[model samples]
Target: MSIQRVVAVVQDGAEPFGLGAICEVWAEPYHPDDDNPVFDFTVCTEHPGVVTGRAGFDLVVEHGLEAMADADLVCISPKHDFDHHAPAVVEAVREAHERGAWIFAHCSSSFLLGQAGLLDGRRCTTHWRYAEQLQRAFPKALVDPDVLYVEDDRIVTGAGSAAGIDAALHLLRRHFGAKVAATAARRIVVPPHRDGGQAQFVRAPVREHEAETLAPLLAWISGHLDESLTVERLARRAHMSPRTFARRFRDETGTTPLQWITNQRVALAEELLENSDLGVEQIAQRAGFGNGATLRHHFTRVRGIAPLAYRRRFTCIESA
Candidate 1:
């Protein structure tokens, strides 16, 4: 199979890290002599040659708009200001979208794509600081202000500079398998993926009365996950009926008690997998999975990998 073609647009007053991120993902040769190449990337400018960056330096690009003709993917990094978008740059962005290219924009670059009407009716994101401006400019676009990135089909937008790496890795995971994406992540020293969306980092929700009462019960349940943690056992610990405990758990955590415990167990299992030299069965027992087979099933469901394989990939214990 042939490599995918990607054209990254460069402009005056561009953020160095933002632009470098796009280039790194699409152009930098990480794996040499690979049978299948990742991407054939070209840096293009509205004017071929010198373009000033946000840090007050000029970068030279030999390719121009013609580079987009063969591009399967087009990435636009943050330029100066939305109001200063060059006509040629906007038109090229529009034309590339019209020709069925998967478009990606990092940081404020989404503003230019929004200006070109490419983000109309599409869910997208930009840097959190400028998210309000982008929303105000393009009311038709669904602007997710809290996300690190939003994947709206062929149009992908990332927030901030480092978040671009996350977005790019997500794109890699979409195109390639999880293993390939994981390999790419190791090469770049970034997280393989972040689950549960960006909502986890926003302001915490206020807990209700019953949930507040479950604190001690929650601590006890966490400590004894190895034992059979049935609803009856938890209810007895909390001095409540099983039905009431279940209802209260759901209301307080916005999820069932069982689900919350499962998440905690999976997280503990991941920590052991990464830090301890324990066998899968040992880790499974400590994390309340009972056995390796049970652990494998739940680990795959939550972490997208088998227990041993995950350990082999992420284990990093330092012997003192």
Candidate 2:
């Protein structure tokens, strides 16, 4: 096998937490006696000197952007500031991509790539707080705020903090197969592959109600997503008029009843598609999408892939 050379570009005010996460997976000798290092990683920066990290630790870099010329992969860890991206840093990323190097950026480093114009016309994600800024700064790049990461062509970006691990594992899987990725994850004590689209920790809109509002009914609705559900039917179950139930449902759940049901149904469909032998029709029924066509439409809309294709690419039944 050919050696894999990777360069991690660091800068001032860089989040060492993200840098450490990248090193733990890619830089360290994960498989000590397996013959060779999985990656030949070099910590690089614009200036070849002692670079201070956000946490006050000194990171001494020996290589500059010139390192990217010979690198198979170029990685960038997140920095704290979103507004003041260095032009030199952006040019290095652009040059690396132009030379056909696989570009990986965790968290806010994606903003750097966006600044460099490499992420234009590509779907990308970053820390949710910076989502608006990323979109405003690079209108050509499609900014997805909810996903853990997005892989558009050779450019891969992971969302904030721990989500970087997910993106790194995905890169591992793409290069070395699920087995190698799993081995690396076991060494690091993390899941080998997390479906990258898992939501960033979002507070559930529904709150507990004092009276019999819609909690039990909502739970029941989740269980029977394939069942024909309507506002009037749900209201009857809650023993309230349709109009009163609609208003109360909004108050209790913090979302309209239909929207809440659709979200749950989609989540259920995703689980079935990932874990079970069920066909599209069966998954749709179980997840309350009505039919295979409906499931396909919503699945493609939300996940950007067909159900079978997603299963083929991501299902780890053998590994699990």
Q: Count of backbone clashes for each model?
A: 0, 2
lDDT of 2: 0.78
- Candidate 2 RMSD to the real structure: 6.8
Tally clashing residue pairs in candidate 2: 2
State each model's CA lDDT, in order. 0.76, 0.78
Worst 10 residues of 1 by lDDT: 195-204
lDDT of 2 by residue, 1-320 (tens): 22299888888888988998889778876446443246788988888998878886878889887888878888897777755677888887888788788888899888888888887889999988889989999999999888888888888898988889888887775655445566677777886655666665544454566355566787788777888889999889889999998887766654577767776776676667666888888888788787899988887775567777766765754211
Cα error, candidate 1, residue 90 (Å): 1.3
lDDT, residue 40, candidate 1: 82
Query: What pairs collide in candidate 1?
Result: none
Cα RMSD, each candidate:
9.1, 6.8
lDDT of 1 at 72: 85
Expressed as tens digits, the lDDT of each residue in 176-208 for candidate 1 is: 534555566677788666432342133335656
